[model samples]
Target: MSKGRLLDGVSPIEGISPTDSLDTLFLKSGSSTAHSPQSLRAKPWPARPQQLCKGIRGWRWWDSALDVVVVMLPIPFFVLAAAVIFVNGKIVDQEQFTILNHSIKGATTLFPICFAAITGRAAIKFATWKLEQGTTIGVLEQLMGSRTVASALTTQVQLRSFNVIGLLMIFVWSLSPLGAQSILHILYTPVLPTSTASSVAYMNSRQQSYSDPRPSSSFPGQWFNSLAIEMGSMLIAPTEVKISSMDINGNVKIPCQSSLLASGTPDSEGWVQTALMNATSNGSLVWSSLFGIPIELGTKLGNTTFSIESTYIELSCNNKTVESLEPDGQNGPRINFTYVSVAGPYFSAEDPDPLDPWIIGYRGVDITTYNDTDGSAYVFPLFCPDCLSSNFANKTIEAGTIAFQEFEGLDNANATTVFCNPYQRYVESEVSCMKTAATQQCQVTAQRDSVLPHMPPEITYLSFPLVALGLSALLPNVTPIHDATNEVQNYLVYDPLDPLTIMGEDNSVLTSGGSTPKFLSDVALSDIETRLGQILNAFVYGSTWNASIFLLGESIDNLQGHEFGGKNASFVPATRADIVAMIQNQTAAFTVPAVLRTQAQVYVCNFAWLGVFLFSTVVMLIGAITGVVFSRKTIVPDYLGYVSSLAKESPWIRMPDVGVNMDGMDKARLVKEVKVRLGDVSYVYGGYSEIGRLAFARLEETTKVKKGKLYV
Candidate 1:
């Protein structure tokens, strides 16, 4: 072969010599001088491969350390996300929550890109290592360059490949997407409803001082007005409020009071025992009412507990028959009704005639009363004059029936009359309250052994009679004495002196007189008992309301002469401080602590997905470390897949034999001054003219292939 031509049968260029300067070759080939080989050699390479290597052992410690750092960069970001979830458990702040979520998404997205760089380099280095070990060209091609999952899969199937190292390289590449998805699921922020601690305010009636006492006659107008308003509320309040006020299980709730006495019957155990009534019986009285003051003004969402004192009524009744004044009345017509009176053994001696009686005569249409064929009258009386003094003294009062028959000829035969005794008591109770936007509810339970001590005699004497007399005056029916000056029309217009007159005789007068007359016979026994219980409830509840008003230090000047005093005229009103001291001493009031609930967004981690992410990260690190370990065997710089590296070693081109093992970088340093082109480098002439061959070669040695030229 000639000096300028290495391949056999290849034609030499007409004007080029093996010793010609590269500039001359480029000028003859009409190539630009801007890209001349000398210019290419002038540019400096950043780091020499020899300098990067630690003697013959390949890369230095710092180089490997840098690689480790790049691979571990994702660890800190993952740890930060984990730490946020671990510490806060929930993120309530909107800005911080959004920032954390976005940061996590960005980190997961970048994970693939970062992992690809490390693993791609590892793949190339691994291929080079295999090549040095004399692997087949097919395996070398599969591992030589940056590869996608599709390309890796195609190569795996095309070679029917079982090469473990090639499969491992493919697995390492697959981790890019896997690790990204795993990390994406590791940290997340979602909006959810959560209960957080917060404070709120509510009206605590139990905390109010209640020991204050005012003269029975003080602030009569205000007292009467308060009493009237409270009574109206008790009668007309919403059914739900009324129902929530009482605990049927014998429990007590704050802000609400129940008149259903405790389970036992009146006995000698204590005053509380003496106050017990059979609430479960058919004729028992049970009344419940909500306090006029609400527990909380506005809606607050949470649950809390508190303590309070509840005043309620308890009554026990027995059947009895009154004796007739006339002997022939046993065969006369009958009348049935309910009545209230103050004529009992405990009546004050100073005021023998205290007040008018309350009478409710049946209009003869209710189930509570029934008539027998024989002449007879039945009257159910709910009265207890000594109940106040007896409860104050912790004694059971069993005053026999008071005889006062309105009819003359009718005997009290087979009568359903009842002699009922009623008393009031205080109980210490715990309350649980729940509030929402739409509703508020409370649950109360009477504390064990929580019956309170009786009010002081002066206090009870001054307050109880006033309550009784006030109730009598405020009630619906009050029959005045015939000799009185004020002529009040009674619903039953029949003469009280005529015993033969039957009830409902004047129906038009009773029904059409602009009054809704109620008949005991029209009401169920249970309902009648309920109404009676409510009346008793008013007596005690009114006293509490009066006490509350007194404790608040309101002026009571109007009540000076209206007192219900007799022998108890020596009683003095209590001061506000006295009430406060009494309440504190008795521990009758309690302060409750409450918290509010709210909704917020929280940071949550899926530990299962976190495990997968950690596992993938670990696998990636192992692969990168493996690549670094194998790189020690690489004798030349990393240039295995570069087109420039392949160009220098081809036998078809005329180039100097520098060395067979030189990497692309080393070979480029030696041949950068050479100019190259793609064209026809070989051709022959024959009887039928041989076709031209095309390849990359020196510009002076090869001619550009014409577009229409027939060459193979």
Candidate 2:
């Protein structure tokens, strides 16, 4: 035997005794084999027939490598998934930012807790030399015990794998279609620059379509734009045919300044100015592509902000455009080629022409050149409305595109105007060919200025004064305007009070206060009297008191002739002759004494109260009688409202009935046989009902005379 590894092989434990060894063998048998010494064998004998495939084969495949991996890979994932469920349960999003805040907290807390628990278990087991029982520690301690430190790299190696696997799964999730959608929302958020703090931002589908200066060149020289909706896609080409250096139709080689508009006398729509103002009170918003756009002051107010976008002169000119106004002859006809930055006396520091803000920056004619006509793309403009208002004379209004190809001739009267943008367009003169450069295409750019001005549309949320407006919608504006002269009077100067008047000392009160006038001028009074009678024309209508209890159901009885009476069910019977005398003879009816009415009320009230007393007394007596008859359980509050459907066995308490005999012999009988005997048991009945509580007790003491054999 190897002396160095005695306990590792067959050596007995240092603490084990001879008898304890035998006890172990007996316990291993599990048969409770504490029989005689001869019966306790080293191994038990058994015969089995009912079962085959004795041990489960799956347990045989479990090995060290399998255990290590299980402790690592799948265990981590399973643990992670379970942690996710706990994480979901813990997220308390009662506010807007809680979702993001809790997510970070959850990740931080979960990792530390799992690591500490797992490490602590390993440490405790190693110190004690233990599994659940006996002396055997876990594998983690074996790895952590390494002295070289490099040997402890198992911890690092294992954790690195976990991170790599987690990262792989994250990448897979991001590539999914659902992940792409989440990314887009964070990137492109909508907001309206001109609305209040409570407002939202949106460019209508129509306006968005017009926003793109260059769309596909399919519809040549076709300009589509609208004031309310987006700038729709359009294809700009020359209006008249001119076969110069290149082909006219299929692929034309034209100069960059080719006119898309025509020329004649400048029409107002052609040459006009426009100013657009967009602002928001608070909250920083991006209009996607525009960065650092100028924010104006006049339109902004205190908390509000405004943004400006500028673009100028986007059309070719013909000799029909006229002479250059600028000193430089290098400039085109009129002020065309002169990229005028901005005229002075136009804007200032304190209030930049509430309409225009940006100081135009025109680096001469650094034009937007297009090499391929079909290569049009929609790039968002880097400009704000305030800046652009100063640069461009007017709006580059455009319209319909592919998305709106089918919706034409939409009506605004009945159909929802929100979804449609159709134009009833008009102009002062015919569109000039100079604006289009005679390119045989519908280059319907405004004729006068390259862009013409348009008045800002009304910024009303709803029309027709929003159904009802101002204080009248929810409350009356109490503007107490008392009239000096009353035109409409309710009272005549010397008239007597009506017999029905409830106010003391009153002529009908005049409407001389508040908005009602006190004096009636003869001219208006004559008109009123001619329309009315010379006398008053009363506007008669019934008024309701909402004391409907007086008019409906049994409540009508509540109002039964209680003039001043204090009685219940009391009234003097008046004969038909008496009623007849009273009605036809008003003098006698008026003479009826008030004392008689008081007497009627007194009688009725006394009778009603007596009835109530009688009813309450009867109910109390009934409740007392029932309470004494049932068990103590009946008196208890627990069973007051609850009743069992099952019947309980009846209890029998003896009562003494006087016995009578037919002959000389008197006899006694037991009405109930005694079953359960208890001394503290009690019974109750009538006043003697308390004796039912002692009914069984009185039985033994009762004296009874019996006829005995030969008794003297």
Give the candidate number with the greatest TM-score. Answer: 1
- Per-residue lDDT of model 2, residues 1-712, tens digit only: 2212222222222222234333343343332443222321222222232222212232223322433432352243233233333433221324522543354344334433333333322332232222222432224233233212232344435444334423332332222222222222221112222222211010000010111212342111222111101100001112112112111221111111112131123334343211011111211111111001111111212222111111111111111111213322433211211221222111111111111101111111101111234423212332111112222323333321100000011111110001111121112111111111233211111222212232121110110111101101111101111232111122111111121111112111122224322211212322222211111101000000111111121222333454311112112233334323322221111111111000110101122322332232222222222222221112111111111100011122221212211101111112223232322112111111112121122222222222341111
Model 2 lowest lDDT segment of ten = 535-544
Which sections of candidate 2 miss by over 4 Å? 1-141, 144-712
lDDT of each: 0.43, 0.20
Which candidate should be chosen as best, given lDDT against the real structure? 1
The local lDDT score (0 to 100) that residue 229 gets in candidate 2 is 12
Candidate 1, backbone clash total: 10
* Candidate 1 error regions (>4 Å): 1-65, 76-93, 104-109, 128-140, 166-172, 178-224, 238-287, 297-639, 642-712
Q: How do the residues 449-534 of candidate 1 rate in per-residue lDDT, one tens digit apiece? A: 23444432222211223334433334332122333211112212332222222222322112333544333233333333334544
